[model samples]
Target: MLRPAFLAMLLAGISPHVLAQPATETVPLLREIKNWVTGCDNLRNCHALSSPSGVDEEDYSSLTLHIFHQAGPEGYLRLRFDHRGEDLDLSTLLLDGQPLGQALTRDLHVELDDEGGDPEMHFYSVIEDAPARRWLQRLRNGQRLQLPGDDNAKVSLSGLSASLLLMDAVQGRVDNVTALARPGKAAASEVPARQPTPVLRKFPTAPALTAQEQAGLAAAAIKALTNTDTEMKPDAEAGALSADQAMMVVRTDCAAYNCEYEISSRERKPPYTETLLSIQPLPLDGAAFEGSVGYDETTGTLSYFYKLRGIGDCGAGGVWVFDGKAFQLREFKMMPRCTGSPYGDWPALWTTLPAP
Candidate 1:
């Protein structure tokens, strides 16, 4: 039988089935997040708690956990632990609790960013990340990073990882530090499997407009969006739907924090065309990656894809077109880092593009 101490090792003692307060509004500091985290010795937030997530409190602190979900900064579903007599391990993110190495490594260098706060506060900004790789380079544009510190020009840099937190009103003499970490959001994004996508029952794609072929226009857009932290490429080639064949359709729309598109496009020469369906406003809170479709379309379906800020052309490759109405594991790939590739990392499952 699991003892209380055993349970405390996974979660912080909260019920995994219970939802903790999210960090949406500025949370009143029962304790500074940084301080509280670096000093968490109790299992209240460490282990034994159970929520609908089945994640124990102790699981939350096991820096080695590969499964971590955050409901934005407001809410988090993670498996981590505080540094108490143990070295903080944050090398990579925990993916389903399995540690991934160079094979899936996206970050190779943890370069420091710009200076953080005013000297009066003696605070500094540093990014706990790898050097500017292709994706990191694109994400770095106009972005700012800083260390969490107190208003008084002071910082106690001990017992902290590469995360953001508030430090004390004093400064530390440390410059750089390293720790062994395990391998590694917002709104709930549900990824659809190879099943048939949902059709509006009545809402088919809008008809194609424009008389001339627009390959040149798509080419132009591709040129313009390169490396600008905009535009995306599909991660992999989706199960192909012939040009305007049957009902294979692709379309998209978005809100802040995310730009989504419902895909159903086909293979055509010159410019590829896709139909535009439901365009939701950007940044639906609590919205993560989502994909689900249940229509009577014999064997065709649509995929839910997103365009994230700072992550241009850096995401999942394509959706898997599974057999037997059940979407199975289609292989996963990353989008090319160049321009003119399938925009965004995930590809449009529907091959039929909207008529321009």
Candidate 2:
């Protein structure tokens, strides 16, 4: 028999499990003509998104579509329309000249004119099951989408073929999934083989702030408290301020997590104003103002960090970078678990911040 030390060494050399750890890969954003966009996540899921040009003369009028694909060769589609001043009652979806019978109304929120005098309406629909597949086919081959409104108002849809093609290529590249089925033909079956999972890379920790940076943050925090746009209304019931009173003074102190500020009126009255801004000591959803906020000189970015309540060690926050005139929010990410797209948590996941 082998010696005890030799046996211990042999056991130490071998791993207990045969499976390797999952690895994550960063997939860059893909853009195509007419502003179509597609991307994939570490889990190999892919999505295609686009906003079609509006029929209305107003520049703000728009309609957006998003398609998502999972590994089971399954997928779904979402369509949204923003009608700020007009009432929209979309009852049907027509591809070319054929009406998709499977279409179902998902949601409708109408703001009456009498309530606020400013009417706003929104329409949303989620297409899945057979209807989603049928819509995909029609988009690949059809030339027009007809939405018959009152008095025979016709809305035109174009550029769908090119958009779907880009999405198909992206899904195929990332998930090895495809939805391009020929007319009157069934889609091919997906293989049962599993794709290799990727390991997730960690983001580097931000460095400590300098004295000058701390001062700057304190100043910004004070200004943020006094700005008219900021919500600084005092609660009379809480005895913080009288009903007619307003904030007349603001002071701030900077810490690693955030800058705490105090607001008061000229009288130095009772129930003084005390609040937290910029950052919070812990990560919690919907508590943006309570997160840790700081400036990173290396990246010229204002970063905020907060805890993602249910997700351990996975942080959620946003980053704002300074433009020529003012700071603008560029990116926000919430990673609950490390398996899916980093930017897939919300609609319009990535935005272009305007310069002040």
Candidate 3:
């Protein structure tokens, strides 16, 4: 188990080296540079993304750039452009006011644009060998990179070098020739191997409860929620119980937009020994509960979705799978700022391996 202070540092995206922990045991990290936010998962796959709103821009722009670097000696680097405007002529793309030239060719870049009206277009390209080295040289010292013409947007390159340097450091690529920010003659073979991902195997599903068992469990949950001594009638809408009647998950309160729920497990029969199940607490508040939660019997998974706003653009969420005894974290993701991005776009702070 991670110490409280260490976990807090990881949650805040502080580099593990700041805490003097071994590199092999480094937790995932997320750090914000001047104009970019960078993060790396346990597997050492690093991602750096520029904000839609640049350092000097007041309004959010429609174009963004994303750079990805995989770990290990043979890992690859990729660059992607997401544009929410009209079709772009690749020939007009600019890197610090100069034409991108043939460095960005259609044969090397794949366009995945939507077909609808005012569709969002994505230009994705994998960079390796000579082109990767040359582009890295240009980008590390460049000022601004943009796509020219109407609906113009620029990603500030101010903090890009520092961001890439951090990525190289995290993956042990400091002086390696493959380093994005600080390349040297050191052989790529010296780079560390990618770490294996953690895995959590879900327990077998519990047997379904009978109608009577469900009703009894529901009543008990309501009584506990209301803090009443005697058994109380269950509200049809809020009555939710696990398949085996061993867990009760239901909403207890709500405000203008957010609703709070409680999760508790108990003994199967009378004089039930019920104990509330608490998920990992959020850094914002000391609370260890979720806004909305549910249980899927077939998969033995309990999931939660908490919305920071009514529109549900930003917030924290996670999934915990039952292991026949207790719940274990499977994944957790959060997007602290709202940028009109979907939940799927959020950076994952925690992740586990797939069941074989």
Candidate 4:
């Protein structure tokens, strides 16, 4: 007596529970396990990171261990826990059933402790020390970590040997440096000597410019300042003038890149005429020129100093010599600005051309 379409709609609205079956528990998919990973920084500092295996998504989000080595033969380890909405108070650490006496807690939210807010916790220990060396030995032999509230639960320390190897490689230490420490003895002193820092190479100076060559270089400087593409020669008819007889002035507009300059010259003769000899653009690959060009008439050494704007005390400069036919780049140096301290002025760490 019912319409076919209506009957079909009624059946579709029925719940399967009407014919009940036994309830089944939901099972979570297993996550890919990453035991430990190693990496290095631009300055060659090395780090090793790891997390516990078999940890669910919720539990793995808040826990990790990190080992770091700076530009030295020493290393350090850190255990991090994100306690954003949970309570965590670490008082002890254990490596392979042996307690780490030197483990200290660093709470980033110490100021917020009195305000009843959760704070992230970091437990740190230096591996170069005696206690840390013992821990490292245990990790190498049988990797395991046990925290205060873990109820004797220990996580396997996989990839620890490889991680230590990576740290040693960064420090330029040999395989012997990875030997485990003896019980009740200090092994920090057993670390191999750190490699010495390499020396910076210096550029050689060029021969002094001749009278005619000086005139050509001066003309080129004038052309560079005027942003012109004119070809200039060191011929006698190009108005050869001595350094004392001709004055050159260089100026920049402080552009980050593609900056141009104006070179004005004044001849101390007869009418004492001033002329814009050349208009040339700055080298497209170079930084902005900071101050005026320096010319040592006695040595015929012309220096061009360039600097990056907004970077404190960092600059690159070059010395050039005239070879009667053209100007030759004799020496070039680039200086890096010091950082992270009140005293920011440091000498140039490198003098070679930067890698492209």
RMSD of model 4 against the true structure:
22.1
Ranking by TM-score: 3, 2, 4, 1
Which ranges in model 2 have alpha carbons more than 4 Å from their true place? 1-26, 41-44, 52-60, 71-87, 92-121, 149-157, 173-178, 181-213, 216-356
Q: Between candidates 2 and 4, which one is better according to lDDT?
A: 4
Error of 4 at 150 (Å): 5.2
Model 3, runs deviating above 4 Å = 1-11, 14-25, 52-55, 105-108, 111-123, 127-133, 226-245, 268-272, 275-287
lDDT score at residue 264, model 2, on the 0-100 scale: 26
TM-score of each: 0.21, 0.39, 0.79, 0.32
Q: lDDT per prediction?
A: 0.24, 0.37, 0.63, 0.38
Instruction: List, in order, the clash count of every candidate structure.
Output: 115, 14, 0, 11
Candidate 3: global Cα-lDDT? 0.63
Q: Model 2, 24: alpha-carbon shift in Å?
A: 18
What is candidate 3's CA lDDT for residue 200?
79
On TM-score, the candidate that comes out on top is 3
Location of the lowest summed lDDT over 10 successive residues in candidate 1: 167-176
What is the per-residue lDDT of model 3 for residues 224-245, given as tens digits with 9 covering 90 to 100? 7753332333232222234434
**Residue 48 accuracy (lDDT) in model 4:** 51
lDDT of 2 by residue, 1-356 (tens): 32333233222312212111112222322332332334443333445544323332221223334555543344434443333333545556455666645433333223233434323433344434555555566465655444545322232334445544444443342233344321223343442222444322222233434354334433443544543343333111111122322222232333343333342221122232333222212111233232345544444455554443323222345665533223355654443222112233322223332332
Query: What is the per-residue lDDT of model 4 for residues 236-338, given as tens digits with 9 covering 90 to 100?
Result: 1122224333435444343443233443444534343565333222221333333335555444445665443343233445555433323345444332222
Ranking by lDDT: 3, 4, 2, 1
* TM-score-superior candidate, 1 or 4: 4
- Supply the TM-score for candidate 4: 0.32
